[model samples]
Target: MHAIVLYTSKYGSTKDYAGWIAEEIGCEVRETKKTCIEDLAPYDTIILGGGLYAEVIAGASLLVKNAAALKGKKVAIFSTGITPLSYREYYDTLVLEKNFKDGIPEGFKVFNFMGKMILDELSLPHRTAIKALKKLMSGKKNPTEMEKLLIELCDADGDFTDKDAIKPLLDYIRN
Candidate 1:
């Protein structure tokens, strides 16, 4: 299939998944910033992984913006986040809508995986933003289910990357 894994990780979780996917698929792995659309022209199957922050995915614009140029290619986008896959409604609805405002491209599929959010390893700015978001959400007298999840996620501190999570994506690519 000539697939390649490209990732944009803020704290390594996305990169970890990309490495695992590449190893299993026996394809090349690279960071999105270090690559360009033209470099991917030869690859028919493209796997793009990125960390999720503030409801937005890091470095996914490259794939989304170049969807036109990728005509006929099979594109898979995986988002790594702390919100847990159990919250399918959030990923299937909220995240999908936010990231694909124009509509998902043809032959494109999206996947969500558990990601790390070690409190101590976070950067100063990211930590501060999390704290502020936590405070803001905590103040809501009647927060929605999504808001409550975000508040809880802000305090999450552990590695949630699972190698098994790559199976479905790999299977899809193989088929």
Candidate 2:
């Protein structure tokens, strides 16, 4: 099957995942900025990767907005973020609700991967936002479980990407 992996990464994690997925599947990889819906016409499978920001997947509107055009293709969308996989509620509920307001389309599959969040590598605005979020959550007298997790995530400062994490996605694509 003809396939392509397209991604939009604010940091490098999503792009890295896209490359790894492409390498494993023997498909073409391109940044979303360089690709458009028309470019997707030739591929039977389209995998899109993006970094999560405020629960939104970067550049995902490319697919969400063009869902009708991609009706028959196999579509997989992945997000890279610092949230731990143990937080099933965060990933399975909050993220899905915010990203897919209209509900997930029939042929689309979603995945989430642990991503890097080195404080030193973050852009100024991101760093400031993290600091602000940490401060806000820290000041809460009785923070909710999710807020507590956010506070801890603010201090996360390393690459959490695992090459092996791509296996499930690969299995889905292959079979």
Candidate 3:
């Protein structure tokens, strides 16, 4: 099957995953910024990757916006975020709700992967945003469970990208 990987990344995590997926599938990979949905029509399968920022999947709206053109193609989406993988509710419900408002396409599959967050690598704006978010969440005298998790995630650092962690996604796409 002809396949292509398209992605948008910040801090390079999403791009890294997109590259690995393309390599594993032996297909081409392109950044969404340089490619349009119309350009992808010839491919039977498409894998879209993006980084999760403030619960939003960066650039994923393009896929939804162009869904009419992408209908009937095999679609897969993956998100790279600092959120821990164990938080299925946050990823599956919260994140999905933020990313796919009309719902994912019928044959599409979604995957989430752990991504890196280096405080130093973050731009001043992003760093300030995270700090402000943390402060807001910290002000809650009786923080909810999710608020506590957010506070902890604010301090997350280091790379969590594991090549082995991508096996399941690769297997699904290969099938």
Instruction: Indicate which candidate wins on lDDT.
Output: 2
lDDT, each prediction = 0.92, 0.93, 0.89
The best-first sequence of candidates by lDDT reads 2, 1, 3
lDDT of 2 by residue, 38-80 (tens): 9899899999999999889998889988999999999999999
Q: Candidate 3 residues 1-175, lDDT tens each?
A: 8999999997999999999889989999999889876898799898888899989887777777788888788888888999999999999899988888898867688889999999999999999999999999999999999999999999999899887888888888778
Candidate 1, run of 10 with poorest lDDT: 52-61
Error of 2 at 102 (Å): 0.9
Q: Write the per-residue lDDT of candidate 1 for residues 1-175, one digit (tens) a residue.
A: 8999999998999999999999999999999999999999999999999999876878888999889999899999999999988888888788888888899999899989999999999999999999999999999999998899989989899999999989999999999
Which residue pairs in candidate 1 have backbone atoms (N, alpha carbon, C) closer than 3 angstroms, thus clashing?
none
Clashes of 2: 0
lDDT of 1: 0.92
Clashes of each: 0, 0, 0
Give TM-scores for every candidate, taking all chains together and pairing residue i with residue i: 0.97, 0.97, 0.96
